[model samples]
Target: MLDAPEVEELTPPVRTLMGPGPSDVHPRVLRAMGTPLVGHLDPTFIDLMDEVQELLRYAFQTENQWTIPISGTGSAAMEAAFANLVEPGDTVLVPTNGYFGYRMASMAERAGGSVVTVDAPWGKPLDPADVQDAFDTHQPDVFGFVHAETSTGVRQPNVSDLTAIAHAHDAFVIADTVTSLGGVELRVDAWDIDVAYSGGQKCLSCPPGASPLTLSDRAMDRVLSRENPVRSWYLDLSQLEGYWGDDRSYHHTAPITNVYALREALRLVAEEGIEARWNRHRRVAQSLVDGLADIGLERYADEEYWLPSLNTVSVPDHVDDGQIIDRLLNEYDLEIAGGLGDLAGDVFRIGCMGHSARPANVQYLLAALDDTLEIETPKTQ
Candidate 1:
């Protein structure tokens, strides 16, 4: 017989989340999660499901009737988009500008796609001309791009132009909106994006579990007509349709608590109005940027393509970024991140997202960063 092991009660530090994601969840959302859970298919829960789908449509700015929360984190939603859309032996085009694009390539390849790249350096948005050239060169069946890249802090400009280029080649378009959905300006239908996916923790201020994914009717058509079964049975949208669609059937138990949290988060979005929310993010992020500049920190991404939700700043010469990051967390209980992949150790990735995108939080972050730098950086002679 084994004795019961002792475990401590759950008490995490109160942190100001200013990192890549899992941003400060809204208090309302946290409260929602605590509400009693009902059966996934109960009558009231079914109604809530309808409301969540409608709210997601508003968030994605689309009326495709295919918008629903995937049953896992944001990456699960991302995989759903790729797995259903890319048929075996199909040529898929993805960008080479940031970390998420590489993730897209890996997912597509797993789905049996021959991946091709349209190159752009880190911290830069892809040029439309380069996209057009890649399409002409590869003649891909599907094209994917990151709308607001978390890794590089660059928002791809000329979205309509890129979509047009893909459409001209009869290629479907997929957008990674993980960092932009509610905080940044994104128009799915207006931009002619065929499919788009986002996480709840980014701009929505909800804890990560259920993720948002939407597809145009045209995109759904391709998914329905795929010659082979989707590699991932768990992420197959066609199978998921029975539950999220009118049938309202079983498709694995939905994440009931996460769904509740997401409902409250999207309710907040509807209350604020999407455009006004975008403006707030921009305004708050601008203050963060100006304060960073005043403190002699240089922005790593260009202003024209800057992602307000995720800001990247250059790390000072000869300073260990980890030391500063550690000081901020230990001394101030604030959270930020180091860059990924190509920009690693060279920049700091600070998130101004969701409930964390407040003037007070930004001011606090700036003050903490200033104090840390003053102490850590070597003094001039």
Candidate 2:
């Protein structure tokens, strides 16, 4: 027999999350997570599940009956969208502007798709003309784009136009709304998006576990009628339909605690109204942007395509991005991030999402950022 290793009680540092994701979860959401877990298919749990789905519909501004929460994190929901939609030998088009577009390409490839790109520069939104051109050239069967590119802090505009272009080519459209849902203006039905997926931790202000995913009837039909079996049995939406669909049977154990937390978060959304939530995020983020400007920081993304939830600011010539980031976390218990991929080390990624989108949080972040910069600036000779 072996003795068990002793470990200390868990006590993590309390951080004011203002990074790209897993933003400050609402207090109500945290309280919900502490509630006792019921069986995934318990009678009470089933009813709660229905409530969650309905609330999700309101959040996405869609009437799709197929909306439900995925059992895992946001990426799981993202994979479910790709794995079920892209069949072997299908040509899928994805954007090349930011990191998540590459993620879409990878997921599609894993689903046996021949991926093509609709090109745009980092920190820029995709042009509808480029999407049209790609469709004309490649005739892809599926098209995917990030509604809000978290890496570059660029929100894609003219979504309806992009969807129209894909529709004209008879291509299915998938949107990555991981950073935009609830905090940004997104309309699934009005925009004619065939499928959309998002994370709970972003604009939802819920801890990451259960994620939101919805597919239009047309998208669901394609998924159900796929020629080959989906590569990922775990993420296969067809199998998942048994649980999330009307039958409400068992597929796998749902993340009950996360579901509870998400329910509370969506309740908050309903209470606030989605449009009002979007306005709040924009208003609060604008304050952050203006304060950064006042402190001599330049915005990395253009104003026309700026993502209000995640603001990217250009790093000063002599300032070390990592040093400032570390100081903010160590000294102030605030969390912001550096850029990813093409924009790495060139930008600071500050998030104003969900509960973190309050004016107080913005003011605190701006003040802390200003002090960090002042103290960390390279001394003049």
Candidate 3:
């Protein structure tokens, strides 16, 4: 008989998540996740499903009946958006401004889209003129842009203008709000965004596995009328409608715990008031920026498009980013991340989001960062 391997009891570090996401989960949401689960198709679970959808609508600021939480992570919701909307040979325009834009292009192509780009530097938001020029040149069937880009810490300004441009060109608009949905200002219906998707681990301060997604009626109509079925069987919105829509039938076993956590998280949003939450993020992140500036760290993104949820601080020429990051994690139990793509090695990504956005966390981060940099600095002559 094979010997049984001895395993230790589970213990994870208590981390202060000031990174790009999975920001400190609210205590209430964490408690919800620990509650006993109901069978996915049980009457009680079905009623909970209705509550989840309603709460998601409130968080996304949409009246779309099609709003629901995808069963997996943010990427699942992202794939659902692209797979449902991009048919074979469809011309899909995606921004080249940040990391998630590249992800969008890959998903669109996998969905049988012919991808094209609207050019912009990594740390800058898509300019209206560039987007318009891309539409005029490519005449894309669908256009996708990042509303709050995590990689570059740039918030796309003039979102309504971008949507208007897409509509005028007779193209559908999809907004990537993974980093913005609950932390920053986003209005799906009023802004005329055709579709939008987000992760629970970001501003929602909930664990991963249930991501928010919503679609306007026109976008849903296009998905329902697709000549070819969506590329991925699991992500097909029309079939998902069987479960999330009026039928409330079984598509796949829902992530009951994630749904519970998301419901509680969105309830916090309603209690706090969405606009007030947005302002709180702005206020808290402003403190982070002020502290960084005092320590001689400059912001990578311009103020006009700076994402309040994710702040990219330029690393000092003498400071090794990896060293500082490790020290913060190991010594301070604080978590912040490094930049990606074009900005890698040039900046550190410090997130002030959700439950982690409190003043105490920000001040703690600043003090820890100050110590990390000071210890590593060379002795003055």
Candidate 4:
């Protein structure tokens, strides 16, 4: 018989998460996760689920009946939204601005969609005219883009115009708000976004297991009327809706612990008030920018298009990004991320999301960053 696995005392580092996601989980949320586990279908748990759905609606700024937490991570929410909405052979207009935008295109393609991309340079917002051109060119059945491009810290300002263009063309607009949902301004109903999905880890400050997904009435109608069933059985929104809906049927065992964490996090959002939370994030982000500038760091994204939650700081020439990130981790016990895909090595992705958006955390990051760059930076001033 195989020997029993060795056991040891469990301990984890107290990290200051100033990176892209899983931003420092609040102590209250961590405690909520430790509460005794109840059965997924227990009356108390079901009540919690109801509250969770309502809170998600408040966060997404939508009254859509289908809003609920998906079982997997943020990517699962993205997949479910696209798979349910885009059927085989559907044309999807996607923006190619940053990593998550490209991810949307890839997911659509995997769902058998013929993708027509509206290309934009990294660190820049999508142009409404270019989106209009894509609509004219493809007349796609679905339109999708990342509202906040996490990789480059760019926020799309043409959401209203883009959604209008898609609506005029009779196309359903899907939005990736993974990094923006609770950290930035998002109005699912007012913006006319048909489907929107986000991760709990970033702005929500929950663990990375649960993802919030919402579909507008029109998007739900499209899902119900799809000629072909959604490709992935696990991600079929129409069926999963029953479980999360008032009927309260079983789909898969909902991530019970994650549900608890999310509920607490959402409650905190409620306690703080949505508008206040938005203002706090903006204030903290401005402080971060000011501090970085004081240390001679430049932001990759222009101010008008910048996302307040995730800031893309340009890596000074000749500085080894990996080296700096490592030193930050080893010495300061803080974490900041390197850029993804094309922007890798050119930028450092710093985040001011959820609980990590406090002034103290931002100041700590600035100090550590200054120390990390001391060697790479030349003496002046």
Candidate 5:
């Protein structure tokens, strides 16, 4: 017989999360997760599910009846949107500006769609003129772009203009709002975004199991009439509809605790008002920006396209980015991140999201940063 291993009681560090995602969960949401779970189709749970969908719509600023939390993280919601919308032989236009845009292209290809690019440099938002040009050239059936790119800390500006271009070309629109939903200025209906998806862990300040997704009637119509079935069976929206839609039927065993947590998180959003929460993120993130500037760290993206939820700043030429990041966690229990893809080793990504978007967290982060770099805080900062 194998010997029993010595395992200790579970105890994780209480570190402040200021990374790209999985932001600090709100206390109420954490408490909600501890509540007892019921069957996915239980009457009370079904009622809670309806409440969640309504709250999601409110947060998305859309009247889309198809809004619901996907069974997994933000990526799952993203895949579902693409898999259902892009059928075999369809031409899908995707941005080349950030990481998630590449993910969109991959998903589209997997769904048997051909992918084309709308080009923009990393750390910059797509220019409408360029997007219109791409549409004129490719005449794609669908266009996908990242609303707020966590990898580059850039928020796509002129959303309405971009959507207008796609609509003029008779193409459907899909948006990756993982870092912007509930924490940035986004209006799905006003902007005419046909499909949008987000994660619970970023601006929602909840855990990662459940994600938010929404589809307009037009978008759903495309999905329902797709020439080929969606590639992901678990994520097939038609199958998922039976559960999240009015039927409230069996599909998969929902992540009960994560759904409870997401409900509480969206409740916080409704209580705060979406616009107020966006402003709060900006206010707190501005303080972080000021401190970074005072410390000679420049923001990677310009102010007009800056993402308040995720801040990317240049690493000083002389500083070893990895050492400082490690020291901050070891000495101060703080968590920030290095940049990804093209910006790797060139920038530091710090998040000011949902529960983490508070003056206390920003001030503490600034102080910890100062100590780690062996630099004194600026008097003005």
Candidate 6:
């Protein structure tokens, strides 16, 4: 066996995640993940799945019957939403403000749909008039956009306005709530979001495998009426519903550990109450903004479009973005990410998600950032 390549036992150093995702998992969730593994179809496990669905509904603040966790990560949930909803030759309008928006456009194209893009600068919200103009120009079969533009820390305000515009044009809406669901204010039912999906890692304070998704009756009707079969067998929501819904049939084996972690995370959300959790995120985010300003850093997005859960800071002209971030990782062992696409290296993304939103964690990041920046700048006096 070639001596098994001289394998050595390894232990991972503890990390404080202050980046885009996989935020620090709570102790309760970690304990839950260690529970004995049970067969996916076992009655007990099925019961837990039902509870998971219910908890997801609560977390999403929606009574939609189709709420369930997709087995893969958040991206899989995003694919499933578009695949099931967009038919071949259908025109789908997508907003181009950040990285995920482009991913949405690509997925729609793969589904054989024609795409029309409504765009804004990276750090701004999609203008309702622009979406209206697209509706007038394309007359799309469906429309979608990101609730929180994670790449630039911009949250679309008055989201219901977009929904109204789409509805007026008789089109369905797919809302990407991956980074906003638990950390920001999202109302699937009240906002009339037809299909919405979110990840467990960011603000849910769970491991990264589980993603929560919900579809309204109108979206489900479109899926049932589609002439062509869903492009993905694994991601086929109609078939997956039998397993995730009433029949509770066997499909793929669920990620038992991830499911356990999600259950505890959702429980924590419910226990804290949704509104209270939103308030906590907002308060911590304000403190983070203040701290960044104190260290002479500037936020990228305007205050009107800023997302409380994730903040994008503009790097000073003389400061080398990568060097400072590297120092933080090597010296303080904190994790933060640089920007994406057009804005890369011009900004730094610091996430104040879930458990990482605690004041102490924010304070640690603030102090480390101040010290790192001071050391990196040359002494003049």
Q: Write the per-residue lDDT of candidate 2 for residues 45-68, one digit (tens) a residue.
A: 999999999999999999999899
Clash-forming residue pairs, model 4: none
Query: What lDDT does each candidate get?
Result: 0.95, 0.95, 0.93, 0.90, 0.92, 0.91
TM-score of each: 0.98, 0.98, 0.98, 0.97, 0.97, 0.97
lDDT, residue 255, candidate 3: 92
lDDT of 1 by residue, 221-320 (tens): 8998889999998998889989988888998999999999999999999999999999999999999999999998989999999999999999889678
Evaluated against the true structure, the overall lDDT of model 4 is 0.90
The per-prediction tally of clashing pairs is 0, 0, 0, 0, 0, 0
Question: Tens digits of per-residue lDDT for model 3 on 165-195?
Answer: 9999889999999999888999999999999
Candidate ranking under lDDT, highest first, comes to 1, 2, 3, 5, 6, 4
* Superior by lDDT: candidate 1 or candidate 5: 1
lDDT by residue for model 6 over 79-187, one digit each (tens)? 9999999999999999888999899999999999999999898888999999999999999988989998889899999889999999999999999999898889999
Please provide, for model 5 over 301-381, each residue's C-alpha lDDT reduced to its tens digit, 9 standing for 90 to 100. 999999999999998877778878888898899999998999988899999999999999998999889878885322221
